[model samples]
Target: MVIVFSFRKDPNALSPVNCWHLILSQCRQESRDHGALSEIYSNNITLRLSHINEDVARLSKKSKEIGVQMQEELLKVTGELQT
Candidate 1:
């Protein structure tokens, strides 16, 4: 199974979170079906699946941080406009 995820910068709101969820879900499913934690580690694949999993986790965390920052900026701008 192959899934592609794209991220776009949204000035008004956070980017889609579902992409990360989809990737994580797919990784879990593949791990279960293959009966191994690191299949790409042993095989010649485009990228090491194990490393991809780690990258996904890191990206997810960064996305959350970016979302929070965007929300804060929006709130600040709204407050300034109100005053």
Candidate 2:
């Protein structure tokens, strides 16, 4: 949003059309920067999601192991009670 105008010591130098061109160039550069930032943000989100999926898979496997152990313990306790 900031437009910088550099001119010689002469007061009446550049025309309005030239100034507009400079402004347009600056806007184009800003737009390109915005696009690059968006791409970076999207890549970061994808990477985080991939890591989260890995963690979820690991936790799920651990949970299944615990469930099996608990079931075995429950069966052992039940048999002891019946005896």
Q: Candidate 2: how many backbone clashes?
A: 0
- Residue-level lDDT of model 1, residues 39-67, one tens digit each, is 65467454567679899999999999999
Per-model C-alpha RMSD:
29.1, 9.5
Kindly report which residue stretches of model 1 are placed more than 4 angstroms away from their true locations once superposed: 1-47
TM-score of every prediction relative to native: 0.45, 0.56
lDDT, each prediction: 0.81, 0.93
lDDT of 2 by residue, 1-83 (tens): 99999956654566787789889999999999999999988999889999999999999999999999999999999999999
lDDT for position 59 in model 1: 100
Deviation from native of the Cα of residue 28 in model 1, angstroms: 33
